[model samples]
Structures are given as structure tokens and as C-alpha cells.
Target: MILSIGCSEPLTTREKGAVYGTLGGAGLGAIIGSATGNAGAGAGIGAAVGLLGGALIGDQMQQRQNQDAAVQRQLSTQQAEIERQQRELEQLRRQQAR
Candidate 1:
């Protein structure tokens, strides 16, 4: 139902950041850990580090997204104004013919 869909909450910026950090950290950690003969420790450390790094990155990404959205909104408004003016101009031309 629409209500159920509406109730489904989106992940917070922090949550997304943490998740990304975990995945990225895990991958990097495993690679480094394997190369160094400490895969277990490497993965653990990587996850921890990644979580922190991801949180920071995610926060920044969210901010950028917000800024981009604002810009898009402004552009849309300007486009609408231009369209309105064009319509008005056409209307005036039609009136002058009468």
C-alpha cells in the first residue's frame, strides 16, 4: 500500500556511509592482509577503518548530492519562467491579429 511504502524509511547518511565503509574496508583489508600473511587481522582492521572512512565519505557525498539537487531545482524554476514568458508572448501576438 502507499502508506506502507511511505512508512519504509530510507537509510540515514551515516548508515549508508558505514555500509560503504565496511564493504570497501573489507575488500582492501583482505587484499592487504593476504599479501602480508595476516588476512584475518587485515580484514578486521580494514572493516574498522573502512567504517570510519566510509562515514566521512558518505557525509561528504550526501552534502554534494544536496547541493546538486538545489541547483537542479533552480534550473527547473528558470526553465518554467522562460516557458511562461514564451506563452505570454505568443498570446499577445494572437491578440494583435484580432
Candidate 2:
């Protein structure tokens, strides 16, 4: 199953995080539950909690990436505008000198 995921198209950050969380949580939960005699329940609860936590973290990270991209784009636009203004200013200066 994990192999298939790796071979297939890359998953979004959220999905990758959730998968890692669920796998890690379930393994840990099972070990703990086995010592306490409730492995099944423990694994289920752990997986759910892990999924939620991982999803939230992944979502926040994704949002940050999007914001960064937007900022980069805005910066690029501002730079172009600045360059354009500089060119116009030079043109005006040359006209005044003439």
C-alpha cells in the first residue's frame, strides 16, 4: 500500500502528513495498548488523533507556502512597476535636457 503511494502521483502535503501520522500513531498505540491489554482501541484512537493533528499542521504549512508565493508575485509586480517608472523618469530628463 505504501509502495503504491510512492509510485503514484505525489500527494499533497496534507495527505503525506496524515499518512505518516497515522502510521506512526498506530504503531505506537499498538505497542502501548498491548502492554495494557487494549491494543485495538488504542490503535484506533491514536490513528484518529494523529490524522487530525497532522492535517492541521499540514494545512498551516500549505497556507504559509501560498502566502509566500503571493508575496513573491507581488514583489515581482512592484519591481516591474519601479523599473517602468525609472525608465519614464530617464526619458523625461532627456527631453528636458534637449
Candidate 3:
């Protein structure tokens, strides 16, 4: 019996962070606002602030990850080229030795 599993893409770190931040902020705000007799207003304000902060942090992290990946790819390509050149040099040396 063979089984195939399909996987769906997960949310990016930025999206996840933003969602968490918004929820957390709203909850906190509501609690604080309730103490002041205005829970709804507190939650709204908290959610907005949380969402903005979370999104910014997430975006920065994502950008950094992308840059790191790019650098890794470049390093890998350079290594491959170096290997190829070494092989070619060895081949040339062998020919000259003969």
C-alpha cells in the first residue's frame, strides 16, 4: 500500500506574529478598558497598536531571513565554481606531467 500526503503552506513568521500580537493586544486592552468602564475602546486601541508592532517586527525578521538565504546561495555557488576550477587545474597538471 502506498500513501501520499499533501501539505499546505504554513503562514509566514510575519503573519503569525501579527495575528498573535493583534489578539493579545486586544485582550489586554479590553481588560484594562474594562477597569476604566470602556472595554470596547480599550480593546480596539490595543489591537491596533499590537498589530502594527507585530507586523513591523515580523517584516524585519522575514527580510533578514531572506538576506541570509541569498548570502548562502551565493556562497554555495562560489564554492561550486571553486571546485570546478580546481578540477580543471588538476586535469591541466596531469596533461603537462605527461
Candidate 4:
């Protein structure tokens, strides 16, 4: 049985961006296409363009997020090492005082 915990974002940034772009493009396209008596065509073209643009933007964002995560992981490891060294130093100080 698979249970989903609400620990993750429902959609990836790229997917979210794509969805938004598609909706916005379709709306705008429909408006313009209606004026030109070719709403369907306009919407199709708009959706395609929007999808491409959104995907690119989302991919960049994802890359940035990945980089940030890597940095965070590195920082965490460093912090743990520092903590361990501090504990070891405390132990040494106790021995020296005895």
C-alpha cells in the first residue's frame, strides 16, 4: 500500500510553469483569435509557444534548485564535522584538566 505524505510539492516547478503558460496562452490566443476569426489556430500557436517558453524557464529553475540543494548538503556535512570536532575537543579538554 502506498500512502502519500504531504511532504512534497504537488507539481514540479517546470510542470507548474507549463500549466500556467498553457492556460494563459490559450486565453490570450482565444481573445486575439476571436478578433481575427481564427481563435482555434491562434490558441494552438499560443499554446505551443507558451509550452516551449515555460519549459525552458522551468528547466533553468530546476537546475538552480539542484545547485542550491547540493550546496545545502555540503553545508550540512561541514556542520556535522564541526560538531563532531567540537565534541572531540571537549573530551580532550576534560582529559587535560584531570
Q: lDDT of each structure?
A: 0.87, 0.84, 0.86, 0.82
**Each prediction's TM-score versus the true structure:** 0.69, 0.77, 0.79, 0.84
Residues 44-63, candidate 2, lDDT per residue (tens digit)? Answer: 88888888887888888888
Off by over 4 Å in 4: 1-9
User: RMSD to native for every prediction?
Assistant: 5.5, 2.4, 6.3, 5.2
For model 3, the local distance difference test gives 0.86
Ranking by lDDT: 1, 3, 2, 4
lDDT at 62 for candidate 3? Answer: 90
Q: How close to the true structure is residue 32 of candidate 4, measured as C-alpha lDDT? A: 88
lDDT of 1 by residue, 1-98 (tens): 22234546877676688787887898899999999999989999999999999888888888888999999999999999999999999999999999
Quote the lDDT for 56 in model 1.
88
lDDT of 4 by residue, 1-98 (tens): 01124436477777767767777787788888999999999898888888778778888888899999999999999999999999999999999999
Instruction: Encode model 3's per-residue lDDT on 1-98: one tens digit a residue.
Output: 01112325666778766877788899999999999999999999999998988888888989999999999999999999999999999999999999
Error at 69, model 3, angstroms: 1.2
Off by over 4 Å in 1: 1-8, 12-14, 27-41
TM-score of 1: 0.69
